[model samples]
Target: MKNYKLRRLSDQPILKTSDVKPSVDGFEVLGAFNPAACLVGDEVILLLRVAEAPRGKEGFILVPLIEEQNGTPELAIKEFNEPAAPYDPRVVTLNGKVYLTSLSHLRIARSRDGIQFTIDENPFLFPARMDESFGIEDARITFLEGKYWITYTAVSEHGPGVGLAITTDFKTVERIGMILPPPNKDVALFPQRINDKYMLLHRPMVSDIGKPSIWLAESEDGVHWGNHRFLFGGRGLADNPFAWEGAKIGAGPEPILTDEGWLLCYHGADPTHSYSLALALLDKNDPAKVLDRSDAPMLTPELLWEREGFFPNVVFSNGWIQWPDGRIWVYYGAADSGVGVAELVRE
Candidate 1:
């Protein structure tokens, strides 16, 4: 495998939780990270997953939920003195019901230099349906035909599922509903169709039989997906519980097409759940055929911001932009709290 390096553009996080304001009135911004980036004309646009939670008080623990009133979404808080389950910062369980500690929604941020950005005050996309009662998160944007197809995770009481939305300009968006059902996320669609069929990479949660891994599927239309094939990770083929990707692996930024093949940047976590970025190349025609993969991660949590935050020791990317000059800009979430950018240099 060829050695590739990801050089950090800045020592500090480019966009932090404090950089973003909460969508709701009483809520506070807990995180502004995991952005899906693309170039609309000359400006780089980011669809960021903004996490919010109600203001903290002394005694009660607050769990935020999205409730609709007159067809408009509003914040609803559930206060609990004690959780039915053990204390977990990510989730709160009470009275046999589970709720997320923070609610997430997609917001827009625009940048002229791809480093510094000005975020939109209001949410670009929020919970509007029962399946997305929790929130929408981790969007991967793929421009197809004449419109951009956004594949994201819709969180609810059921589980995390893949949802789709379409937009030409960021001003207006059309929700296409859930594309892939619950227990699935980390979905990225290939920019162009392969073999006259649309393709995507997804990670489905597996516990009873196998471990979670990256899988490939095909569809005539981008909405309905099938032809499921295991590409990497899971029970066999190594990398599962290996050094860096010992715990699990998921699709990161949308696959980039190159002369050699399709370059895929993905994230893998060790047993400690420390996330890092890795690389893989797939056949130009047959994406399921892996050409070369990184023996180790090209980028890992080394910076202070990356090692500590809401959920520490993590660096994940769901969006990136490869400029016309062949310069690749990788925008990633650090410690699940802040957004950072790096340049991927191929030697």
Candidate 2:
């Protein structure tokens, strides 16, 4: 096995919330991060999860939500009275019901150098269905079968679920509805079929008996999934060397096919809820068999931008672009607020 290292580029956040304009009239762009990246011709494209919210008012807390009215999804703000104590700025318990502080939608960003990006004025994907009424977020893009397949989280009152969409041109996208049911998310589809079946990586939440972990599922038509199996999880508890992922782990960008195996980038959260990025390798023939994984996080929240903001101490990614020469450009969300990139190279 060869050693690898992640080098953070000089330009820390390639994109910021201020760079994006809100879709709603009175809403403001809070965060523009966690992009799904890809290459189209000579241009590098990003599908960014842009979170927006209305300004706070005195003695009241406002929650942005997507509501369906006359078969059209509109951005709506629900206000709650005073001292509505929040678990975090991202979430709040209002009248015994949980609500997100912001409503997220997918927006387009294009770049020629992969560092400087121009954000599109309008949204690419928004909360249209009831399942995505809360918001859609954290997309993973995989180019397969002559189209770009996007797997993202569809959040609603029920829970977060996996939703799929496809597009040939970024201008138009067709939703494939929800593939995985509630309490599941972080989905990434393999670029190609293995052993005559489509393979997908996802994370399922568990509360009572087990913790959230990465799992594998198989699909025959790329819509219906089955043959679910546990793929990876935290090594052990606090004393364990891999405890950085003790709280939970989820798949990041789509797996890259390498000579050694399938190179996968993933995020792991510790007990403190601090998130970091790690790498893993799966068997080329049998993806269910884990070949190797990182002992420690390759990318951690060290910089001030990564350590502070909305939902601090987090570095999460669902996107990366690989060159023919094996250089990988990893685009990550720093502090759930801005987008940053790092270079993954073999040492």
- Give the candidate number with the greatest TM-score: 2
The lDDT, on a scale of 0 to 1, for candidate 2 is 0.91
Off by over 4 Å in 2: 70-72, 84-87
For candidate 1, give the lDDT: 0.90
The numbered model that scores best in lDDT is 2
- Candidate 1 Cα errors over 4 Å, as ranges: 68-74, 83-86, 234-241
TM values, all candidates: 0.95, 0.97
Count clashes in each candidate, considering only residues at least 3 apart in sequence or on different chains. 1, 0
Worst lDDT 10-window in candidate 2: 82-91
Worst 10 residues of 1 by lDDT: 234-243
